[model samples]
Target: MSDYDFELPDARIALRPAEPRDAARLLTSYADGRLEDRIVRDLPQILAPGDRLVVNDSRVIPARLVGERLRPAGTARVELTLLVEDEPLRWTAFAKPAKRIGEGDTLRFPVPGGVVEGRVEARTGPTVTVRFAADPLAAGAMPLPPYIAAKRAPDARDESDYQTVYADPPGSVAAPTAGLHFTDRLFSALAERGIGLSRVTLHVGAGTFLPVKTEHLNEHEMHAEWGTVSAATVAEIAATKAAGGRIVAVGTTSLRLLESAAGEGVLAPFTGDTRLFIRPGFRFHVADALLTNFHLPRSTLLMLVAAFAGLARMRAIYAHALRHDYRFYSYGDASLIFADPR
Candidate 1:
């Protein structure tokens, strides 16, 4: 939103995740927006041995379904991205042909693999509320982001690739992408080098890609995302702070969860929802380094990067990345960012 402009070739989009997690590429940009290219495998060499690496292990759920219009009969298939569950069978959804749908209707799926039935409960402008009677995933499909172009719907294969290796206690609709770059070897190397590790969970939501539409920036209301910080992770951060160890947030989600939990320069154990929006002039209470993917232009995630690393620097970095052909978005490559010094 800050007048940052750049062009990215569609050819640079990464269709699939990099193999051997740690084998993915990495971009390191300076506070001044200088660029450096390296392999993800070099993380151990890039970061200091004692720095704490905090990661979000929230796994993505199979939240997309293909259903059919009931009243119209033989109508085109409707694709629904289940947003948030309100009750046991009740959910808020982003339904396609959003034009043809209305309140108090039912949707049927001809999909052979997953759950096939649901009744529309309500309609609030863009969202179709549905109380699912079937386990859609069993009959439904996994929903990929709007960025990743695909021919067919989600299948059993997506059940695996759409998740991270450390994903446990599944709830997120999107993967904590930074974790995608870590395999056992990467962890082992970090451990062998005495690099510290910590865990935090932020159930990423569909709002992750929601663009910043407000100019004041402060007026942009961030959707609250549920997060949890275990005692162990809190202890790690506390000890790191006590020992003067810097906190290296594995992803923006983890960074947000940690900063949300930190109120008075000390991190407390937390388990709840947070809508802490980071923008220009907002002081970061915790986290020193961030490992994140290249985000979409004019997106909230991009604003977060701009907030963490100066806005001008981030724009320059994005421009540099675009020029250097760095992959962009969810399935793309990653960058290691340091918090900006104001």
Candidate 2:
């Protein structure tokens, strides 16, 4: 809400991923306010031995469902984006044509095996909670981000292209995109360079795309997301810090989870829901540097980067990115940002 805004050219949006995952462009913003252009494959040259790169392993689930709301009058087409699960069979979702739906109405979704259905239990605006008779995961399609979805329909290629190679825990509605640039070749390259890797989990929710509505950023209701930092991951972070190695978060999800686990002091093991809303003036306790993609304008993700690197510095970085016509959004280029000492 705080004037965190900008304009981006349409051509800057990347409709598809880079041919070779490692071939994507990378913008490096150093602590001294210097910017350098590099490709994703140059990580080995940018990072030194002992530097640990923390990544999110949460897999993107095909959570978008196309169904019909059946009633005595007629059937109405409905689209749902599953947001979060409160129970094994109950989930909160964003529904299109939500106004036409009422409580207790059945929604039928077709899938490969058979038809799956859910009953709406409650509704609050566009958000609805539904209890499914059968698992909806099997019937859903990859919930592509609005920006990408606006450009093209989700195809079979996206099933693999949108996910990271390390994705394991199946819960997120969207990909931890920074992880998408990685491949077996990139992993081997990082390993040969002595760069260590660690993982955490943050089931990214639908709220990631919700715009900041309040004029004051603090007044915005940050959506809570489930995440976990095991004792092992914390140990790895501590070892990296102790060894004078930089802890490089592979994406904002990893960085946010680490900071949420750290609280105000030292990094620690944690597992729970985190609604941590980072902005300017927020102090970071874990990540020494971050490897993330160019985010949407005025988005919380951009604000988080502004907080990690300085706001003025971030503006300059984005200006460069826009001027150079670097690809943007989920399938776009990435940036390696170092926190300002100040």
Candidate 3:
């Protein structure tokens, strides 16, 4: 855990995304310890023709809700960030002022037309299971990362800015930040360059924003995220590999799902929950290269990247990013890292 810790200045964090999305800076970190400063739009020139880019198509849902909890004395303001849907109109969420909420308490969230009501079904620590009278999407707001939300409120711009253009399956509480750099114009360029594109689904959970609480890496337990790699995607990746092409994962989410599905030494269609905690010394079976964002210090994401590239190399890369004034975190700059040879 100490190996992953680093000092990052607060001003380096980006509050808003780059204009046009593809204009964000990209740092190419090579296994040979070479680094190149580039932009997101340069992907066509950066990647080869036969290379396949696997992207996560998981959509960010408006999961944050501000409501009032009915109390015997009076109503108290409550906040909930929906984590996962257990059933139709039923969800597990993290409640603010968790001590104030109780089982059987009614939650009322005001929406455009009216209020969306809910009943607390269960509570465990700060998290609660609630069954709503109707879909809460109507009253919910975009759930921004805690680092960003602490600074500013989620607004109209975030609704479009926080989501990828190809987002289809609505489940994720957070955006796959690396994929946020892509746009239609960039997609056209990749397509024209003959770089094949594939999609997988990994509903990024709110756990992605949680901090590493344990002292040692092994002591930390990862939150299970629902993901799927379909048969079509598996075939595409296999064909790309057979043709001597690289599998470039657009983000860690896609990379994790691909690795989870390929645990048998060969890629197979997979659909289920995954709690894959990738730290240093982990073996790589898929994803020849990775395009991802600069993660927080001591974060699981940073550890995974360190595992993919070498730890020393990652430290050097991060130092370069900081020295060069590169933006950090979600809605920040990106890094395309080529994995160390197996």
Q: Pick the candidate with the highest TM-score.
A: 3
Q: Which of the two, 1 or 2, has more lDDT?
A: 2
Which sections of candidate 1 miss by over 4 Å?
2-5, 30-34, 72-74, 110-115, 150-157, 340-342
Off by over 4 Å in 3: none
Q: List where candidate 2 sits over 4 angstroms from the true fold.
A: none
lDDT of each residue in 127-177, candidate 3, tens digit only: 999999999989999999989999999999999999999999999999998
For each candidate, what TM-score against the reference?
A: 0.93, 0.97, 0.98
Candidate 2 per-residue C-alpha lDDT over 157-269 given as tens digits, one digit per residue, 9 for 90 to 100: 99999999999999899889999999999999999999999999999988887778777888888888999999998998888889999999999899899999989688888
* Predicted candidate 1 versus true structure: per-residue lDDT over 1-342, tens digit per residue: 645445567778776777766788899865555678987899888888678999998978777776677785555578787777788778788887787787867787655654477888888766889887766655545567777735345556667767777888767877788778888888889888888988899999878877777776778888778999998899888788788777889888998899899867678899999998876666787788889998877777777788888877787778777777777777678999876555
Better model by TM-score: candidate 1 vs candidate 2? 2
Give the winner by lDDT: 1 or 3: 3
**Whole-model Cα lDDT of every candidate shown, in order:** 0.79, 0.91, 0.93
Give the candidate order by descending TM-score: 3, 2, 1
How close to the true structure is residue 128 of candidate 2, measured as C-alpha lDDT? 95
